[model samples]
Target chain A: MENTALEKSVLNKRKTKSLILRFMVWLCGILTVGILAYILLFILVRGIPNINMEFLFGEYNSDSLSAFSSIVTTVEMIVISLIIAVPVGVFCAIYLHEYAKRGNKAVKVIRLAVDTLAGIPSIVYGLFGMIFFVNILGLRASVLSGVLTISIMILPVIISSSEEAIKSVPDMYREGSLGLGATRLRTVFSIVLPTAMPGILSGVILAIGRIVGETAALIFTSGTNVLENPTLDLMASQRTLAIHMYMLASEGLPYSKDMAFATGAILIIIVFIVNFAATKLAGRIGGLSNGK
Target chain B: MESIKKSKFNDTVMQSVFFMSAFVSVLAVIAISLFLFLRGIPAIAEIGFMDFVFSEKWGPVNTPASYGILSMIVGSIYVTAGAIVIGVPVGLMCAVFLAEFCPEGIYKIVKPAVNLLAGIPSIIYGFFGMQIVVPFVRDNVGGNGYSILSASIILGIMILPTIISISESSIRAVPESYKEGSFGLGATKEETIFKVVVPAAKSGVLTAIILGIGRAVGETMAVVMVAGNAVMPLDKIALLKPIRTLTTNIVTEMSYASGLHESSLIATGVVLFVFIVILNASLSLIKFRSSRN
Candidate 1:
């Protein structure tokens, strides 16, 4: 009888301990979600009121603090950086997956370089950009300098994602193409690339998201100069939307805070759209690859 | 015969093209290191290596000007340590919740929320810190709004998605047989998790923590806004006092900095670069060992 009573008490203690741990787990999960919700709502609620049509499309001046020029600059940055980074990144992925022999010294060197690139902090990239692109190369704080810097920064992102997409291509596709007398180049172009396009494009979209949001790297290279009239000149030093919001906030003018909040709201919306599109595309890649 | 030969030549050419493309990243890495060292080493030599790195004074405009970064280095370490303390436990618990305890319906909501958190830009995080966290700290805590405490909280929040996603994936990767074996030994679910499953995923969890450290230390725009940009003396450094990190030190002065001041800022970049390289090497080591196991 005494032994049975002791056993029952031990069981109760174990139950209580498990219950407490489970409660802590739930609490932490809730806390994570709660913080995200708070920041999102806080920005959107205060910012939505300040974003008028004029704020989005009007000329940027000391008075209105419009964002139309910055919007143009952001788009240009994305397009230019993608144009340079995507082809190189995709080709690098193809070489790693299809061309290089396993355990090759060159392959190891390339892999290390890619890994190193990925691990580098953005501020370091900024410093490098300032020194190499701006001063040595004489690009002089132009969009071209910034674009070159950002292109290098996003190369790893593009290469890794494209490599995964390329790796997922079924071996049978290559075999069947070769069996039917297609050349190696022909098979890769017609068979592998077409199938991997969706996945590669999804990666490109993610890189676009990175380019759109980048600030630190661009600050020293591209600069925060706002163009009174938006233009496509690569030589012009212009600020993106993120930089605009940062400048407005840091300037500490009386009205700049409201404008900064509005600009931030716009940025959040763009990011949400980009994130949604990438997720959808990534999901489609799995389906298309597996369904075949 | 001619067609096959011609096609073979085409393939060779294309392969060379791809190889050159792969070499670009390698070239970029070399270029970055070379430029940083070349620009930075001269300044470090000029400042006297020991005085530059270990001394506390950072006055750039004084008659003779002193350029020491010991305080900024300390500031970086303190904020990173604070971030690790605050972010790791919460992130680990959340990971456990998602991997083991979350229902399918809740996972859908939580997963997207975490993704959105990762997608948010650092600039926006900085702005949010400027508006919300800094003010909150000033009112509730002892010192001014902009202090080490505020930067830590923001960074801790910022690193959450990184730690959670990495940890959750590694936890899920733990083989089912391990959990089943623990259960068969009469271990309850919670006990099995903390004692058996988490221990099994130890290397992966360590990787998550290290990556979180990398992010916290390298973070710039957000830390600048909340860290008050004041170069505090080493003895004066406190949680509630304004402090400058290695990253913030460069940015706060880079604009107006001229001559040696500019070079000194680049030297600061060189120091930050070394820290990242060390972190990266350790990460690779962990990955290599785990893969071998």
Candidate 2:
């Protein structure tokens, strides 16, 4: 009788533990969903109403914080930064994956450095840019400084992604080109690069997303003034959408609050679009690699 | 013969180009380190290390200036702890749910939502926190709204994406045979998942939490917007009191700061950098051990 009673108690304990875990699982899942829904809805509802034509295309009026010039600066920075970052990042990735010998100390050092760079805070990048580029390089507080800083910031993302892409290409492709008596340079450019193009493109796209949303790094390098000079000149201080929103929020202008929200909404939408495209590209590449 | 020579020359050129590209990352890292330390160390020496770290007062503009980072250090620790407490359980469960329980249709929606959270910029997060979270706190708990609690909530939300994705992948990567073994022993599905799969993914879970901590500690803009940027230590256990963190201390003052004050802020960045380095080293150590296993 005593053994039976003990067994019953043990069974009850097991049941109670299982029930609690199950409840936790359901509760946490629901909370995640709820919080995500609330944030999305809060931003969209508050921001979408303020995004009129004037906000999108209006002239830069400092008092109002219209985002047109900010948007323009965002696009220009993206272009300039990408121009500098892509070729270099892609080539670096290729050297690591294809050319560098395994177990090489220099290669290991480079990898560690890149990883360290990746983990540093964005604000640190701002500090470094403020000191190195703006002060030391005599670039001053201009778009050029911002572009260089952001390019370095995004370099790790580009290199890591491109390296993975290049590594995924089967060795048989390289071997076949070599067997056909093609030079290594011709084989990589003509045969390997085309195969890895989709993946590289996706990496570049993600870099664009990062460049557009970046703020702290841009805070000092890019300067705060939203320029309406309507030029691609890199010397002028310019504000991207993210910085514009930050400036508005901190300065406590009652009228410009909605404008900040509106810029934020647009920024989110752009990031969402870029991320979607990236995942789709990555998925297609995954499918292709599996098929091979 | 001429063509062969030409091909060899082209190969050399391309290899050098790629090598130079690879060298740039290393160059940038060296440059950053030299600049940060070269400029940061002198400030500490001039200001006195003990005074810089221990003094509770921060008055750079005063006639007799004082630079103490103890409060901000405590504040960073407090807010990060709060974030981990609030974020970890929910993030882990959500990860488990995603890996084990979600229906395909629901998974589709949930997955993208998490990704979008990551994709959204911190500045946008700050706006949301400022407009929504800050006010909501004021209405409910009532401490001027921008407080440690506010920073914690925003940061906790910010970290969810990192926690969920990493943990989900790690959980899914657990060998199927382990689960089957647990099931054959007459354990329930929840029991097997909790007992078997979670333990197998333990290191990965730790990595996720660490990564989340690193993110929460380093986060600046969102925290700045909601944290209220008070430069004093909390006298009591109050989440509603505003506090300053290391990253925010640097960004807020760096705009106008000059001379020793500027270097002190950079010195603060030095401290932040050291914290991140420690976190990264621990992460890589875990990774190294796991790979060895």
Candidate 3:
């Protein structure tokens, strides 16, 4: 009787410990989700009321209406940078995936270079932009300089992600196309590229998100003057939304706090929209693959 | 024969384009390195390297334009160290629970949350820190609104996603056979995890930590907001006082700076670049060794 009771108690203790362990795991998962939700909710609540059409379209003034110039500048930079980066990045990804063999030293060097570039700090890119584009090339605080700098900053991300996307296309497709007597270029451009388009689009969107949100690189390369709707001239320095928000928060002028918060809200919305679009595109691609 | 010749020509052209693409990326890296080195060397040569690195006075605009990056470097180290201290354990534990202990439904939710965290911009993080952390620390820690402690906390939060994701992947990559073997030896699940799995994933975990360090070191906007921007290095008495980091110092001073001062700030960039190069090389080496082993 004594042995039976002792064994029963030990079994009961083990059961309780296991239950506690299970509960702890559930609690951790809940806590992580809770914290993230809380942060998103807090920002949305604080920032939403401040966002308005005036805020999106108005000129930048410390005293009067909201600064929309920053938004325009940001969009311009994004367009210009994408114009440069996407073609180059896609071409590079194609080169790596389609043409290069496995054992080439040049391929190895390129891989290492891209990895290292991705690891380098944004501020260093900004510094380089300052010296090379602004000084030597004489872009002089223009949107062109910002575009050049940001292109280099996000090039690795675009290339690597697009390369992965392209590589994920099965070898069977390539073989079938070639067996049909199609040229390699024709095979890649039609069969592989279209199939990889969703992934490439997703990569581009993510890169755009990074470009829109970036501050450090822009600060040095793009001059922080808040102009109202900049023109095609690349030499004029312009302020982006992030730079505007930083300036407002740090400079401590009148009504700057309100403007900064409002700008932050706009930035959040823009980023959220871009991120949402990218996620949706990725999901659609995933679904298509699953359907196959 | 004609068709064969055409195909060969096409292959050559495509191959050349591939080679050129690869070469351009390498050229970019070389150009960046060269520009930074050429612009930065003059300032370092003028300042005498040791004093430039170790001295505390950072004012580059006063009578003599005294500039030493010592305090900023210390501040960077202090904050990054604090962030690592807070981030690693929590992150590792979270990773453990996620990989080893969680059920499928729970994993689904938790995984997306981590991804979202990783996706959020750093500027928003800075805003969050300013609005939440700074006020909380000022009210609770008996300091003014900005301090190294606040910066550290924010950084800790910022780096958590990286740590959790990387560590979780590593822990998951731990072979299942090890777990079965441990179980067969009459080990409990907890013992199997703590003993067998974590050890197997040690190098990966170490890599995660190194990556976290790199993030913390390179982070600028968030640190700029919370670190109070003290130009000079603080004494022990002023540990809670705000101080500049190397990145922050460069950002803060670059606007009004001219001549050697501007060049010295760029030199700061050189220092930052060197640190990143060292970090990348070490990480690659570690990864290489780990794979080989």
Candidate 4:
């Protein structure tokens, strides 16, 4: 009878322990999801009401603080940065995957540099851009300086993702091209790159998202001077959308709070679209590369 | 054979182009390091390294300006520790839940949610902190809205995606054999996970934590918005009071600062850069040792 009683108590303790652990895990999961939902809902609910046609396209007066100029600057930053970064990044990835030996010293050094660059803070990038691009290079805190700084910033993202995509291309395709007496360059360009295009494009989209969302790196390099009219003279000092929202929040003009919310809403919407597209591309890449 | 010779020449040119492109990142790293040290070390030398790093006074405008950043260092450490404290356990549990417990339907919702969290810009996070977290802390936890505690909470939230995704993948990577052996020994699922799987995935979890630290320490705009940017003496620093960090020190003063004041800020950037290099080195060390094992 005493033995039976002890076994019953031991079983009960084990059951209780399992129950508590399960409860805690579930609680953490719920909390994680809940936080994201709350932040998204809170911003969208308050922000969507304030965004109208004028808010999107009007000039930034003391009363209105429109985002039209900032929007144009944002697009220009994205385009210029990509044009400079994409070819360089794609070529880097191709070299890593196709040209370098597995344990080559240069390959190792390149990987380390990429990792270190990615780890460096955006704020540090901002400071470097300020000192080097803005002052030393005599760009003088223009959009061009910001573009140069972020192009370096987003290179690792592009290189790593593009490498992954390139690495996934079946060797059979390469072997066949060479079998047909095609030059290695021709094979890579015609067969491998096209096959990896969806993956590479997805990575480019992710880099775009990073550029769109960056703030600290742009503030000093780009300078937060708002243009009265939309212009794309790379020399002109401008603020991107993230910086615009940051300035609005920090300066806190009377209507700035409402305008900040509107800006935040717009930023979130862009991110959602970017994330959705990247996810879709990633899904498509799986089917394309594997099915072939 | 003229066409063949032309193709060979073209290939040689493209290969060199690719090699040059590949070398750019290495050149960038060397250039960044050289530039930062060249510009930043002068101020450190002028101020004296011991006085700059160890002293707490940060008066850049005083007649005899003090350029010490000890308080900011302390502030960075405190908030990062606070973030790790608040974010790690919850994130670990969430990772385990996703890897071990969540059904397919819920995983679909939770996975995208985490990605969205990662994608949200820091500026938006700053605004969120300003509008929401500051007021909540002001009312509930004491002190003014902008406090170290407020920064900690926001950073903790900001780092969740990094910690969760890395930890979840690591947890999933643990071998099925270990779990099977645990189950064969009459261990419960929870016991098997915490004891068997988690212990196995410790290095990866550790990597996640180190990366989270990197993210939290390097974070600036969100922290600046919430962390009241008060340059405090070492003794006066507290959780509910405002504080400055190394990154914030540079950003707040960079606009108008010139001469030594500006250089001192750059020196602060040097300090931040050192901390990041150390973190990155340690992370690589962890990865190397783990792979070897």
Task: Return the top candidate by DockQ.
Answer: 4
**lDDT tens digits, residue span A185-246, model 3:** 77888888888888888889989888887888989888778765545567778878788888
TM-score of 1: 0.98
Candidate 3, CAPRI quality class derived from DockQ:
acceptable
Positional deviation of B28 in candidate 4, in angstroms? 1.1
Q: Model 2, B1-293: lDDT tens per residue? A: 99999999989998999999999999998898889988998998999989888877789999799888888888999999999988998999999989998889989988888887787889988888998899999999898998999999999999999999999999999999999999899887889989999999999999999999998999998899999898974464378988999999998898889999999999998888889989989999999999999
Comparing candidate 3 with candidate 4, which one achieves the higher DockQ?
A: 4
Off by over 4 Å in 3: A1-28, A230-232, A284-291, B1-11, B237-239
- Each candidate's DockQ score against the native complex? 0.80, 0.75, 0.48, 0.84
Worst 10 residues of 4 chain B by lDDT: B27-36
By TM-score, who's the top model here? 4
Candidate 4 yields a Cα-based lDDT of 0.92
- Model 2, stretches more than 4 Å misplaced? B234-237
Candidate 1 structure quality by residue, lDDT tens digits, A71-171: 99999999999999999999999999999999889999999999999888889999999999999999999999999999999999899989988888888
lDDT for each candidate structure: 0.92, 0.88, 0.81, 0.92
TM-score of chain A of each: 0.96, 0.95, 0.90, 0.97
Off by over 4 Å in 1: A1-4, B1-3
- What are the runs in model 4 whose C-alpha is more than 4 Å off? none
> Model 1, range B249-277, lDDT digits (tens) per residue?
98888889999999999999999999989
TM-score of chain B of 4: 0.98
User: What is the CAPRI rating of model 2's predicted complex?
Assistant: medium
Report residue A273 deviation for candidate 3 (angstroms).
2.8
